[model samples]
Target: MTRLPPVRVARAATTVRTAVQGLTRRMVPPPVGVLELVSGLIEANTVYAVAKLGVADALARGPRAAADVAAELGTNPDATYRLMRAAAGYGLLHQDGDRFDLTALGRPLRSDAPDSMRAVVLMIGDPRYQSVWARLPESVTTGTAQAEAVHGVSMWELLDRDADYAATFNEAMTRLTALDWPTVAAAYDFTPFRRIVDVGGGHGRLLASMLGAAPAAEGVLFEQESLLPAAEELLREAGVLSRCRLVGGSFHDRVPDDGDLYVMRRVVHDLDDEQALALLTTVRRDMPAGATLLLLESIVPPGSGPDFAKTLDLDMLLFAGGRERTEQEYAALLDRAGLGMTRVVPTISTISLVEVRPAA
Candidate 1:
């Protein structure tokens, strides 16, 4: 038997302890699991409250007294103190005396962070989105958008009318896309293609990633006119502006038929089957033989086990009049639109790349 050094023995012991703790956690069931489910709403709303109050943003520099944070944010000191306490309990912040500081998990909440989730937090907590979620029960009962029932308009219509809300929504989408694009860019091979068209590509971030990954490929960004400035700025920042063309158009009427590859990320899930089919048909009409269509969206898995898509399906139901689809459903939808599903490529992110080509 060989004797180990004291430090090495202690490190091995610590590793074993960690492994045992992990296994134990996996083996143990939560006490009153139903209560855990019921209390999730409390945690979610508390997180939202802290996010909206900009508490994390206020503490970006260093730990601050809760009252000072509240004063800076124009919020009530007592309420802010309580909010910070709750956030600290949730491990989003650490409390010391009367000061609160962000923990590792909470640092991403700061707006200055590269991959900040602040936009996501704000967008989800906004009254416009929350109003739709509140009517989710009605959506479940009627198989239609709860927003339509409550606000007498679709989310798109609401966005069109409310510029501020629309900007927030776009920022949220950009933040999410930024997080997911690196995975998609790495998982797919875009080198063979010369031209890539991104339909409904907001800010052109994903397209920029694609273009960056495939140096030889030029890009055509097609989106609403209002998004042009932002997309141009992103493309320029990526140094791919000279290689890309920005085109403002509606996919409902027509799409550019020249590209060898077309990408629509997180777009199809905003419509019902009829509308989705219509948009697909428009693209199919212009899709030359051997061209590819890449849908970058969540593919709902077969069974239920804490899947993000399952939850997003509900959000689609209440707000966008859409639903996440299984692999078979995507195939069938593609077939109907005269496109063939070649393969579904899984990425490091939750979203998958559903690759399709014009039906022979």
Candidate 2:
């Protein structure tokens, strides 16, 4: 009824226009972010090509044209180019003239490259893991591990009993351990302790790194009986076997309580609350009066902010029935074990060190 001011009317119109623009933006697709979705699909699909063709391992010989690679591997040249082109588009590899050269990612895909992604290619491309990913939508709806549902037995149990899978599974862990070493060695200091015990130290790569970093420090590598031999060889090569002890036993059964520093890296997250509590409890019982316990893991950040480790959490849910934890979650677990949480050291962007000493 009352006459409106011209300035106010114009301002309101401007506000409405700006709001519509924002709404339009929200509805419109983003350019760079969408690239990741496309890339993820491409990587998952092409993982088969490299894993089956042994392209990653073969690349160590040197880059070759799609024609030559297809000939050596006995595949259609055009098909191989399509596959390689997909990878090249994602910066996994590059096509220089006719030859495909290793990018930063391609280098790691090589078997010779330390902590390479070759095992990743194998594991992700393998049927057991692959089938589960196909059932991801089912998991999303039901909130359960599709792997367990499809395969019947648990992922761990299946890997344990299957001879072929066991070897590949162990090798994959060893490879991941190798990938983690450079960042860990650069960031963590192992000099404070003379005797260090690595629980569930697969292939002893972590222990080797620790011992290498602290030449004066002796190490004990603990794992299942079958894994001990492999650990022994790894430690032997690192020249720490003289000082290293291989304890082929379970942490649930008993831990070697001889060391001042007891460490477990990426081990606890592969368990549910009950098993995690039990494992931590075992460590607590075996820990010396003044021993230091170092839990190497990723301390999940609060909220939905981007986190590399969070993806691994879903992986734990899918394959391992385990989980990634927030810092609060880690504290809760430590509390249950009758241990106190001390300082947590951020190792690399994707990992951290939870330093827990004896609770006074």
Candidate 1, 1-360: lDDT as tens digits = 133234345446656876775666566476645566677878878888877778889999999999999899999899899999999999999999899999988888888887699889889877777778888778888888888777778788888888898888888888898888766765689999999999999989889989988999999999999899999998999899999999998999888889999999999988888899999999999867778999998989785345678999999998888989999999999899988999998765678999989887
User: Candidate 2: misplaced stretches above 4 Å?
Assistant: 1-39, 57-63, 96-98, 140-143
Best by TM-score: 1
- State every prediction's TM-score relative to the real structure: 0.89, 0.85
Q: For candidate 2, lDDT tens digit of each residue in 75-124?
A: 88898888888778777778886688778877877767854777767777
Clashing pairs in 1: none
Question: What lDDT score is found at residue 179 in candidate 2?
Answer: 70
The per-model lDDT (C-alpha) reads 0.86, 0.79
Query: Which one is best on lDDT?
Result: 1
